[model samples]
Target: MEIIIGPLILVAQVALNLFWWALVISAILSWLVAFNVINTSNQFVNSVGSFLYSITEPALRPIRRFVPPLGGLDMSFIVLLLIILFVQNVLARLQYSIG
Candidate 1:
């Protein structure tokens, strides 16, 4: 029982770390999308952008609702990235504090 619980906790922590990393990449890609660095109108770009949007949009939507665009620049991506960073730090601390 003790061995199982210890391994499970380690697995959970690793999963959280990977998720935070994914958020970081997603945020960078979102910036690219916003800047028109990779035009989504192109067929290949559109497909990839659509897939990324499906993954990240749910996380971005609430931030989008509360944080409006400023100076024609969307700030939600930054906000989302900051939130993910906060969450990752908190989880890392929790992992240390636990074991």
Candidate 2:
């Protein structure tokens, strides 16, 4: 069990880390666009923004349902970040225990 579960947990942790970065990037990109600091009209900018939205939106949508945005400030992404962190920590602990 340890042989299989250990690697699985590690993979899960890595996946969570990648996802956390993606969410952070998506939020920052959105802010840049909102502030007019970055022009989405550029092909690369538009493509990146669209890709980020497509990947992150599914994870964010359910969280948005309950938390919503507060005073026009969206906290869903932050909430998701917290959840991802929690899961990653748990996975690390489990991996350690198994190893």
Per-model TM-score, in order, reads 0.66, 0.97
Which candidate ranks first by TM-score, i.e. highest? 2
Quote the lDDT for 15 in model 1. 69
Candidate 1 displacement at residue 62 in angstroms? 1.0
| Minimal lDDT window, size 10, model 2 | 90-99
Tens digits of per-residue lDDT, candidate 2, 1-99, equal: 778888888788888988999999999999999999999999999999999999999999999999978899999999999999899888888877776
RMSD of each: 3.2, 0.7
| lDDT of candidate 1 over 66-91, digit per residue (tens) | 99999977788778767766876776
Instruction: State the TM-score for model 1.
Output: 0.66
Report clash pairs, candidate 2: none
Runs in model 1 deviating more than 4 A are: 1-37
